[model samples]
Target: MQQNLNYVYPQVFWVDGCTSASASSPSAPPVTPFPPPVPDRRTKPGHNRERRSVGFLVIFMLILLALTGVGLSMFQIFHLEKELAELREVRSAWPEQSMEKEARKAAHLTGNPTQRDLPLEWEPISGHAFTDGIQYHEQGLVVNETGLYFVYSNVLFRGSICSSQMLTHIVYKKNPTLPGSHVLMEDKGINYCTGQKTWARKSYLGALFKLRKMDSLHVNVSKIALVNFEESKTFFGLFKL
Candidate 1:
């Protein structure tokens, strides 16, 4: 066959009549089988949908765990608070606590605190002689049971906070200070407790009854004389012996 002059191609022809393409432009090599899919699932096609770096994934999971832990802790706290409220309600329903609160209030209102031992304002009587003795007096003697006996001595009878005020207070004893008393002398002027005496009233005899029984001064006065209050009067100190 004649050569086709219109196609001056570079293909080599074999002298034996076989035609061959040039090695430089040989047919493409057959494609090797696609590489086996990577063993790691991370590189799969679906992974590209919302890809995350390995470090970022780890960080996100850690953050979720922290949030879950915080939520759980808050739930526990609220649950404990609820339980505590329930317990308080149950306690308030009990009767003994109400009684206890009332008892505490009563004790505080009426009870004297035992913490301190203060001196009592009371004093004891000398004896029944002071309690059941009759009233008597002597002249020029203080008759410490002195009463409004002397008008001039009334100035000395004035009671004052200052001891220098010459104020005199006479304390007396009576056998029976009751109304309708018969205060007889133990032996006339020999009955002078401290001697000097002025006029004294039988009513003042009740002072002895109080001192011996309650150990307290029922008649608190700053003057020495036959002073009267209501039906009571200051008395002469009784002298028995």
Candidate 2:
């Protein structure tokens, strides 16, 4: 039985057979293997990097939007202040030939007080007239009443350039009913003229259509507060006005 153990190679080609059988067949077709699976093309490392960059750009844009809002608010506030000043200047000059009348009024108002019917309290001066306390100063004359207030000035005959030049303290209000001369600013708005020359200043208030008075009793003011701290609300002069 072992006499024919050797295998004879086949002359015809064989298909889909074991390796050993295929080896014995000289005409066996070569086997083809599937290529390694193609790597996932859509989820590459570079693609993930681009997605992260886009997310960061979106966050940066949101931060820039918030900063822009704050800058706009500051700009608006500054413009409003400038416009208000110009309006006051126009309003002050509403009287006839301003310079001549104011000079005459200032001369007569020295050492005199202007009298008003309004109760001694803080109130608007645009349309209202104060008949009470009228005092003169180097800067101008002032009409004061009871209670703390920040009254608006129309225009000064002599406006100061420096803050110190305009600095002044406000004396508290005095009762007209009291017997003694209402203290001419004994407590506040005092400026020493020891080193400098005392400048004479004046103020006048009246309308073009109305007749103005020239009664003298208003004290000439030396304190320059009406011009100083002009930009501040100035409701109180260290007395919580």
Candidate 3:
């Protein structure tokens, strides 16, 4: 029993075999090592505000651009409307102006033929008579306006000896396209008097015609000697419709 023996350490007493100090301390609450400090993932308040501000700015810019576009479009439309209104006003006034101009073109002329059986010549009835629409040349009335017109003429025939010969009166027109003058109206009379005596007759012509510019009108009679040269008895006139 007294033999000398070497003390051998128990395997359970070794630090590697025993529980760790962290597990042994019961009074200190469990030293649970917190997982390596987790990095904060939440965005900062300032960063969030900056992102919101950026989004707001972008939206505001988009809205501003839209408003500007709308305003420009409205302005353009208003301008176009104003121009259209002005054009309409001009169009409305055109007809009245044209009518006034046409009214000023009325002409009343008196026959002034120097020979018989020839085309009747004419002179302005009054100093204020308008003859701009008509041209008097070679015993003809040349039309300068292409429109419907009321044309009138009167002629007085008188003779000391009534031979009862046929009297022919005609209104002739010469068109720019036609080669010759064509009779527009004609009147004939025979046996107007029974015996050899003074005889007098009056012929009048009035009609509406669609005349073209450059057309010419003239009067003709079978006998030039029978015509009375009185201005009041022989006249020609025209007025636009």
Q: What are the Cα lDDT values of the candidates?
A: 0.32, 0.35, 0.77
Name the 10 consecutive residues with the lowest summed lDDT in model 3.
10-19
Candidate 1 residues 203-240, lDDT tens each? Answer: 11211221222111112233323123211122222221
Best by TM-score: 3
Q: How many backbone clashes does candidate 1 have?
A: 12
Going through the candidates in the order shown, the clash numbers are 12, 17, 1
What's the lDDT for residue 91 in model 1? 90
Clashing pairs in 3: 116-224
Q: Give lDDT tens digits, candidate 3, residues 28-89.
A: 44323334568899999999999999999999999999999999999999999999999999
Worst 10 residues of 1 by lDDT: 104-113
Native-to-model Cα distance after best TM-score fit, residue 207 in candidate 2, in Å: 29
* Cα distance off (Å), candidate 1, residue 88: 0.9
Give the CA lDDT, 0 to 100, for residue 169 in model 2.
27
